[model samples]
Target chain A: MRKNNLKGWLYLLPAMLFLGAFMVYPLIDVFVYSFEEGYNFASQTYFDIGFYNFSYVLHDTYFLQALKNTFLMVVITVPVSTGIALLISVGLSAVKPLRNLFQTIYFLPYVTNTLAVGLVFMILFKKTAYSDGLVNLLIHWFGGASVDFIEGPYWAKMFVMCFYIIWVVMPFKILLLTSAIASVDRNYYNAARVDGTSAFRIFRKITLPMISPTIFYLVITGFIGAFKEYSDAVALFGTDLNAAGMNTIVGYVYDMLYGDSGGYPSYASAAAIILFVIVLTITCINLLISRKLTRGFS
Target chain B: MNTSSQTNYEQISKTSARQKRAVHVLVYTGLALWAVMVLFPFYWMLLTSVKSYSAYNGERFPRFYTLSPTLQNYADAFTTVPLGRYLLNTLIFTAATTALMMLVIILAAFAFARLKFKGRNAVFTLFLSLMMIPNELVVITNFATITNLSLRNTFTGLILPSVTSVFYIYLLKENFAQVPDTLYYAAKVDGTSDLKYLFKVMAPICKPTLVTIGILKIIECWNAYVWPRLITDDENYYLVSNGIQEIRENGFGRENIPAMMAAVVVISVPLLALFLLFRDKIMTGVSRSGTKG
Candidate 1:
């Protein structure tokens, strides 16, 4: 037993060290650093600012807008993406032939470079001087006026980003939910059918109840993911993450820390901490709510 | 009376069969539509990559298909940017990070799964809780640490922070735990050392999960845009994703769009091939990770 314990410790040492240095240390350092005001990255100089940094970030128009945009993304994306995924998985579960082919097609989006595809969408949605782009061409084919997608109003940009998130995230959710739907006992369906249960009723009661846990899982994780939206925004709008009026919190923080306009690492740290707190609070709330749903299932 | 009842049963069966066929048709149509929607952007990307330069940015309306297709854009992609070099860097980073992650995760997972250790459960629980903390929160301090260590622009800076994945460790641990204890002791009775047992018996038993994690990690590295962008200042160290982003941002003219698209296409092709070949494993791996979370 003693020898086994020693061996285990030896095995765990590297991982502990790595996580300690990278994760635990950074977490504490950032929390501490978030309190400093006007801290210079080069000079490594700072004075204790208490909650002033948080207050400043809260009051700042850009940061507040970013906070709102991030929340909007989470609110709009989680349900829309998860809902679409649920519907698709239901359709997919009914089919047997060419199922894998369709899945592979859908999953290609998840595997493709998000930034690269965001760039493609950027170009596809752009309205050129000579002609509306591909999307517009299709609209024109139907005798409808072209809609400005990228350079349009704030809500239009938000719509585009939300559309991108939904499209990209649908595959994973569908994959999960399809498997979830598949794993539910076949006998239940047989029993329901024997009683002459209508198809929609069978799905609504049996299928939905059985797959409620998976849906809950998707919603919670999807909510957390939306808050961290950064690269897609960058890919679509370049460094000009601001379009119309929307900017993601992560993108705003990135500009502060790494953008060419010089960085205030300390302020960025505070913003990140704020983002962290928001994520934590939301996760806790989700867990609290999900406990009720999962308990009923159990 | 019996013959009439039999005819009624036959009529009901025939109607139900027709209904089933109708249901199948609806399912297929819906899936097909979504699949087309999913594939349309990729098709457009490929189409745009091959369009003649004039068609790409001409005064004429955007054409869906070009009368003439050319590889000039692909050629320009290579010429204008060190795409091949960026690809090589990304490949190196992917391989290196995946190898390091596997080595660390395997050993740690084996320890957590099989070994009798003090505070083992406590340590494992701590790691699990760490997973809840979004990585974005730590990027600030991590950036500072890397800069302080003077690791910026180096592959070590890119690989080191991400070398040990807590999630992969947990997945492998779950896989390792499923291995029966009797086999492990039997190997011990046969004079197998712990490391030998792990390599010879444990690893093979968990081969599928390991492969899944390996592929996912590779894809993660391939799609990695943020950390690589932050760490590497020099173009030589730029990963393919960020490299294309930089080109799209910095390239001066509207005419460069095709070349940029070509670059995106080149970077994306290998991943598409990988996905096609290992579709089942990738999907299973993802779903497994999701449920575990």
Candidate 2:
């Protein structure tokens, strides 16, 4: 038994060493740095330890803007994308012929590179000396005036951001929900049909309840993923996200550490901790609600 | 009276069949519309990629199809920037990271799943909790650590932080546990070493899960942006994720839209092909991860 223990530790040693250096230590280092006011990266020293870094980060307008953007992204993208995905999935479930083809087409975006996709989106929406972009052209065709979705009004940019996010994220949600809807017992639907229930009522009473767990799961994960969005904005708006006013919370942390106004580890750490807390709180609340709901059902 | 009731039943059946057909039409129409919406950007990308730059810019309105498609932009995508080099770098990063991660995770999973070590469950729990720590928090300090080590612009720096994934370890452990214990006892009776038994028995049994993990990890490493972006400012080490951005900002300015689209098309094709090829495995892996949450 003792020899077995030794062998186990030996096998685990490589992973443990890497995790300790990268994951575990970084977390502790971030916590310590967040509280260390006026820490200098060059000298590796700090004047004092306090909550001043947190206060400074919270008070900063750029950080606040980033907070607002991230919150809006989470609020807007999660429900809208999930609902759209659910509709698509339910539609997908009902159809028989050509189902695999449609599923494959929908899942394409999931595998595409984010930056590459962002560039495609940029060209599609961006206005230039050449012409109004494709989207604007579509608007004009529909007898609506052109709106510059990129490099335009704040609302327009936000609209484009939300649309792009929904476009990129919905594929995975659709894939999941399609499978979830498929896994639902056909007997429930048959019984509902025998009772002469309307389609909407059958969906409401049987389909929705059957798939609530998956929906809850998607919502929670969506919130977490949206909160950590940085590269998506970087891809769309460029690396200088603050100038574009579309910076996310993760982007803020990167900017604090390495952007034009960078070299402030303390501030970055503080902002990171704030993000951590927000994500953790939301996840816990969702978990509690899911537990209650599942318990009620079962 | 019986004939009248039979006629009434036939009428009800015909009406219900008509309703079902209408529902099917509605469903198919809706799915097709959404599929077009999902696919339009890719279509647009391919269309723009083949159009001549002057032709792309000269249009008063963007056309859905190009009459005289040229592969010139594809050539320029490789030449104008070192997109070829970026692709090579990405290939190297993905290969190394995935290979290293598989080794680390497989061993750790083996230890957790089969070994009777003291405090094994406790250690496993600690590893699982590591997943709760938001990656952004860890990334900040990792940047500092890599810089402090002066390992910037090296593959080692880019690959080190990504070589282990707790989630993959947990997944593989669950898979490994499903292999029956009788096999191990039989192997022991044959005087097989634990390492040999693992390689000979457990690994073959869990090949599907292993393949899924490998493919997913490759996709992840291919798409990784933030860490590589942070650790390597030198253009030599840029992955395709950041390479595409560099091409936009510097190599080809905003004026060269078609060339930019060409670059994007080249970068997106590999993974799209991979997903199409392994659609089932990828779908099952992703769905499994989601539900486990």
Candidate 3:
């Protein structure tokens, strides 16, 4: 047993060292840095230490904007995208012909580069001197005024952001849910039909309950994913996200560290800690809700 | 009375069949519409990439189909910016990171899954808990550490922090544990080394899971943006993700939309091809991770 223990640790050594340097140490360092007041990056010095960094980050307008944007994104995108994906998955479960073709089409966005997709979306939505863009042209055809989805009003930009997020994320949810629905026992549905149960009621009572666990799983993961949405915003609005009024919490940390308003390590660490807290609190709440919901279904 | 009841049964069956047909049509229509919404962007991308710069700019309203197709933008994508270099850099990063991560995770998973060790479960639990710390927190200090080490703009810096994934290690451990212990014992009794047993027996048994992890890791490294963007400001070190962004901002400029789209198409095609070829493996990997989480 002693010899085996030594051998086991030898196997784990490389991974342990890498994780110690990159993951564990950074976590501790970030936590400590968050409390250091007005730390200088170049000098590697700080005069004082307290919650002052936290206070500054919490009060900063850019951080506030980032917080608001992240919250709205979380609130809007999570439920809307999951619902849309569920509908599509359920529809997909019922279809027979060309199902594989449709599934393949839906999954395309999952593998494509986010920035590349963002550029395509930018071209599709941005109104330029030469054209009104395809989306605005469509609006014009429908007798609605052209709305500049990119570089436009707050609501319009938010709409575009949420729409883009939904489009990108729905494929995975659809894949998972479609399989979840397919795995459900066929006997229950047949019994329900024999008793003359309506399709809607059958869905509500049987199908929903059977797949409730997967639904709850999607919601929890969706919330977490949306909270950490920096790249998507960067892809859409460029790296100067604060100026675009669409910066996420993660983006705020990056900006503080390495943007036009850069070189504020203390402030960045504090903002990162705040993001960590928010995500943790929400995850806890989601876990609680899912526990109750799943138990109720069972 | 029997005849009347039979006729009634026939009438009911006919109505139900018609209703089922209606539902099928509705489902297909809905799926088709959503599919279009899902696919239209790719269509638009391919369309815009082929249109001439002059033709693209001259349009008063965007045309869904281009009358004259040109490969000029693709040529421009390569020449105007070193997109070929970005692709090469991305390939190097993805291959190095995935290969190194696979080796590290496999060894660690073998330890946890098969080896008898003091504090093994406790250590595995600790590793699992590390996943709870969001990547954002870790990334901040990693940036500082990489900079302090003066390893910026090098492949070593780009590949180091990404070479160990706790989630993948956990996944592989579960898979490794599923192999029957008899084979392991038989090999051990024959005086085969642990390393040899791992390569010869354990790995081949878990080949599908291994492939899935490799494919997923490649996709991740290819799509990685934030860390690469932070670490490498030098154009020579940029991955396709950030390289394309650089092209958009500086190389191509915003005015050259067709050229920009062409750049994007070049970057997106490789992974698209990979996914198409290994569709089942990727889907199973994704769905497995989703449910297990």
Candidate 4:
């Protein structure tokens, strides 16, 4: 038995090696490269301790916009999607025959390739002076003027962007919350019923608390996922071949590396390192906070 | 709990039947509306994909069966985009990466679940916390790593960074914990190696979870766009999603939107079909993942 147990450890070694080569190695290299003066793809010469790389990214206007946009995206998306999905999922708990079917429908968007979804939106949203898309079609139905959704930073752009993310995200949340809502003992509901408590009250006191842990779980992950998304920027917004300044932080990193490095991408690497630190730090904080909040239940 | 709840719940249920009926109606209405919103875009994409240029330019929605619908867009899509190459690349990437991730997750999950080593909770917590870090930073550093490794345009480079799925480990580890240490003891008694026991015993018990994670990894790998685009500058290395973008970029002027949509529809259909085929497993996988989301 001991021999076999050791064998299991050995089997796991190959995977560990791959992780070391790919994940651990690169992660360390990011720091090393970031601290270096400059890296030329042509020569691969990395020399100098230019904190200037980090300083430049820190001072860049577009980088700040990307950071702002990315943060706003996470803050707005996580709670909103989780809250709405929780509502829909709670509603779904009592309905059996329709539950799985509807849940599947909601989850469809989540599973679909975001690339196609983004492209589809671009075509659907295409509105010039004379043309109309789906939203415009609806507005016309209401006897209203057609509006270009992606152009102006009106309620329309925010609305479309939010709507797109919410659609993609809601399914995952609904599916997750459905299980959490189901986890609550039916006895609690019965007890409340025996006490003549209203359905809403039972939900507030029992259902909400029971599902708080799951809610926290979705929020942090959702924030991370939504924040990193640059598909909409690249696919839906502009035509720089890589969707230029609708730049999310990740998009900005991409722009720096692939777009115009001027033969030296060390600055982008520095920016990337800072981003890694930020994400690592923020994620750790989020986990600690979630743990603290749901210590008892989790 | 069931007995008392059954009695109290029955009383409340009997009294609230009418109210619950109203609630049911409202709930269904809300769900139906949401379902439409969630569902309509995909439907619209399909509908628009099939609509001919005349119909697309002319009508809001196709009304009759008499109108000519051609697979021309599908044809143009395939021809216009290196969709064949993209699909092949995506399939290969997803399959390879999924295989790799599943192997790592199953093993690491076992280690986390069964092995008694230091930093167990702390390490698990680190991986779980890794969940909260958006891919933005990782991807940027990943690009830098790729450039350094000189793996800039390779398949392995594309697949390497993404194969580390922390959440999958959490789910599998949680499932693995439920296997009752009795099994591990039995395996030990039989003198099976830890690796063999994992594959031979724990892996079988965790099969459902494994399958679920496998499907997810495949779907996720297939859907990968941002990193692939960043890492690979050429269309030769493009995955299906980014390839679609390449198609759009190169064929922008002459290709009609419907035809382009036809290309998208083609790109997406296989995955959608896969989703339908494994709908139950996928839902449960997603649901279970969500339980701790």
Candidate 5:
């Protein structure tokens, strides 16, 4: 028993070292920095600080806007994408030759850089009608005027990002759910058919119950991704657009790092900590829900 | 009853034939249209990459898709910037990280799935639970930590922070558990060492899953824009994604859509190649994980 235990530790040592150097050290540093003011945006110096940074960022108007945007993004994206992906997965499962092709297409977006992909969408959705952009061209052909997508305050910008997020992230949720979806025994469906039950009824009675755990997984993952993601705002419109959009807390951190920043990065650290806490709480809630749902996932 | 049965059979057969045709068309239309959407931007990129500056700048639709297409963008792309260096840097970082990750993740997964260790569950659970934390959140202090170490803008600073992957560990563990224990028992009975057994027995069984993870790691590392951007400031450390973004911002003209599109095509082609190569492994892994193969 002692030898076996020793062997196990030997096996685990490499992984532990890797995590210790990277994950644990960085985490500790973040906590440490949260209590201090970073110095010299140009020279990039670190200095001492009290709780003033936290208090300032807490009271800032931008903090509130970031909170609102982050939560709003989560509230919209999680259930919407998970539900739609499930529908698309189910719809495609009915086809044979096209199944692999559809899966590849669905998944291709996930592999591409989200920011680069977002740029493509920006080009497609430019304000002008029929001048090289896709959506505008379509609108012009339909005798409708082009709409300025990014110029609208906050919501339109948020919605544009959300639209792309849903389109892009759908593949991941579908991929996982497809895993759970395939596990449902075909015999149950055969039996249901013998009893004259319709496909919809069989799906409700058989499919939904089995895949609840996967659905729950998607719920939490989608929410977590939504909350922390918006670094792409910098990629899309650079610092100026992100500051105006108010769509993500992460973007706020980037803005504070590079923008006027008011000489207080300790506040950004505080914001990061709070975002971490909220996301962690959501994760805990998800764990509980997953445990409950997965009882029947068997 | 007999006369009504014949009528019902006739009606049902006709309806079924029409429905089958409709389903075929639906399948074709839906799949084909999305496929087009998926490939059109790519098509545009491929075409634009060959267009000269004058032709690309022209507002009128270039009379033909391939009218006197040139390879100058490809040439200019390499010559105008340090594209080769960035590509080399990305390749090196990706290769190193993937190798280390595979070794670390595979062993840990084996220990968790196969061996009996003290605090085994505890360690694995700690790793799994932390999977929820956005990797971006860690960058705040990671920047500070690297700065303190005087490793900023270095490849070590960029790649070291991401070497630990809970997701890959979890995935490997899940797949490893499915490998039959009888293999282990048989190997032990044959007086083979645990290392040999792992290499000779479990490794082959888990190859597809590992390939899937490898493909995933390549994709993530290749597209890792934010992390690399945050970690490295020097042009020497630029990954393809970040390199492309910088090109857009400071390198190219906004009206130079063709050149911009060319860059997209170039960045994407390797990924496309890798995906095509591993397409079979991807499906197999999915099927084993209960998704379609």
Candidate 6:
């Protein structure tokens, strides 16, 4: 028994070491660094300012904008993408022909690098004052004034970001919800059909209730993902978050840590911890709210 | 009475057929619209990449298709910067990260799944909770740690922090637990060491999940953008993601949209092809991960 314990520990040693040094240590370091004010990276030293760092971050206008942007992304993208994905998956489940092909097609964005796809979107939405770009071309056809999506005002940039997120996230949710829908028994549909129920009623009353678990899953995971939105910002708006005034929570942290010619690790670390707390709190609330829904079926 | 019932049945069947046809139209229309939305960007990428500089900047609104096409942008993309080298670095980083990540995950997952050691549940729960902590939270200190170790601008710096994913460990643990405990004991009774049995028995049984993890990890590493950008400052260490972003940053000032699109096209094609080829594995793996989580 002792020998077995020793062997098991030995097997876990490498991974444990890696996690300890990287994850656990950094986690603690970030917490500590969050409290250190004016911790000059060059000098490798700092004085602890108690809760002042947190207060500073809380009062900072840019940080508040980032927090609001983060919330905006989560609030808008989650429901929009999840609802669209649910619709798409339902439509997909109804069609028998070329279903796999369609699923694969839908999944293209999920596999493609976000930065690459975001770049593609950047090109699609690039400034075309003459309505030359693809999006602008569409805008022109509708007699809508051309707006420079990437370089436009804050709302335009956020609009572009939300659209990009929906495009990227819709695929995975579609895939997930499709399988969840597929797992529902076909007999329920047959019963509903025999009762002369309308198709819309069948979907709302039967199909949706059956797939609520998956819907809940998507919402929870979607919120988590939206909270961590990063690379797309970098890809869409370039590295200058201040120029765009569209800094996301993670993007704000990232720019703080890396954007400056000199480092602002302390502020960045504090912002990161704040972001982490917000995510954790929201996720816990999600779990709590979803408990009643998920508990119904399973 | 029989004639009336038959007439009613025929009427019902005919209406049902019409309804079915309507449903088909709805399904196809919705699917087609979404397919167009999904594919439009790629089409846009290709279209923009092939447009000639004169046409791109000429006194005409850009349309979907170009009457004349040129490969000049692709040529310029290769020539303008070290895109080729960046792609190579990305490939190296992805492969190394995947392999090393898999090794770490398999070991840790197996230990968590089958071993009856002390603190097993506690340790497993700890790892599971670790997944809740967003990676961005830790990246700052990780950057400091990497810089401290003088691993900056190296593949190690990029790979080390991300080597062991808590999520993958949880996934493979779930997969590993599904293997019958009897087999593990049977192997043990037959004098197989735990490591030997892990490789010979558990790993083989979990091949599909392993492949799933491997594929997902590859895609993760491939799509990784932020960390690699943070760690590497040298042109030599740039991955395809940050490299393309950097190219876009530098390119557009010269009105090099075509070249940037060409670079985007080149970087995107391989994954698109991979998805086409391994559609089932990728889909199954992804859905499996989702459901299991």
Against the native complex, each candidate's DockQ, computed on alpha carbons, is 0.61, 0.64, 0.64, 0.42, 0.35, 0.59
Regions more than 4 Å wrong, model 4: A1-9, A153-155, A238-244, A260-264, A276-298, B1-12, B59-66, B103-135, B148-150, B163-202, B252-255, B290-293
The CAPRI quality class of candidate 5 comes to acceptable
Q: Report RMSD for candidate 2.
A: 2.8
Pairs of residues at least 3 apart in sequence or in different chains that clash in candidate 4:
A1-B191, A4-B192, A4-B193, A4-B194, A5-B194, A8-B194, A8-B195, A217-B293, A218-B293
Q: For model 6, what is the error of residue A5's alpha carbon versus the real structure, in angstroms, after optimal superposition?
A: 1.2
Question: With candidate 6 superimposed using the best TM-score fit, by how many Å does residue A113's alpha carbon deviate from the native?
Answer: 1.2
As a whole number from 0 to 100, the lDDT of residue B257 in candidate 1 is 76
Task: Write model 1 residue lDDT over A102-139, tens digit each, in one string.
Answer: 87888888788888889889888877666567777778
- Model 1 stretches astray by more than 4 angstroms: A293-298, B1-13, B252-254, B291-293
TM-score of each prediction: 0.94, 0.96, 0.97, 0.86, 0.84, 0.94
Report the Cα lDDT for residue A122, model 1.
86
How many angstroms is residue A42 displaced in model 4 relative to the true structure, after the best TM-score fit?
Answer: 3.1
Error of 5 at A55 (Å): 3.5
- Per-residue lDDT, model 6, residue A128, is 61
lDDT digits (tens) for residues A103-163 of candidate 2? 9899887788989999889888888766999999989989998887778898888888988
Query: Where is model 6 more than 4 Å wrong at Cα?
Result: A128-131, A293-298, B1-14, B291-293
Q: For each of the candidates, give the backbone clash count.
A: 0, 0, 0, 9, 2, 0
lDDT of 5 by residue, B33-105 (tens): 6566666656666776787888755633233376788887887777776777778998999999898888888
Task: Show the colliding residue pairs in model 3.
Answer: none
DockQ score for model 2: 0.64
lDDT of 5 at A56: 67
The local lDDT score (0 to 100) that residue A11 gets in candidate 6 is: 72
Model 2's CAPRI class?
Answer: medium
lDDT of 2 by residue, B1-293 (tens): 37875576556556678788999998988888988988888999999999998999888788889889999999999988899999999999999999999999999999999988998999999999997777888988899999999999999999999999999999999999999999999999999999999888999999999999999888888888988888889999999998998887888776888999999999999999999889999988987775221
DockQ of 3: 0.64
lDDT of 1 at B39: 86
Q: Candidate 3 on A232-274: residue-level lDDT in tens?
A: 7888888889889999999999989886898887899999889
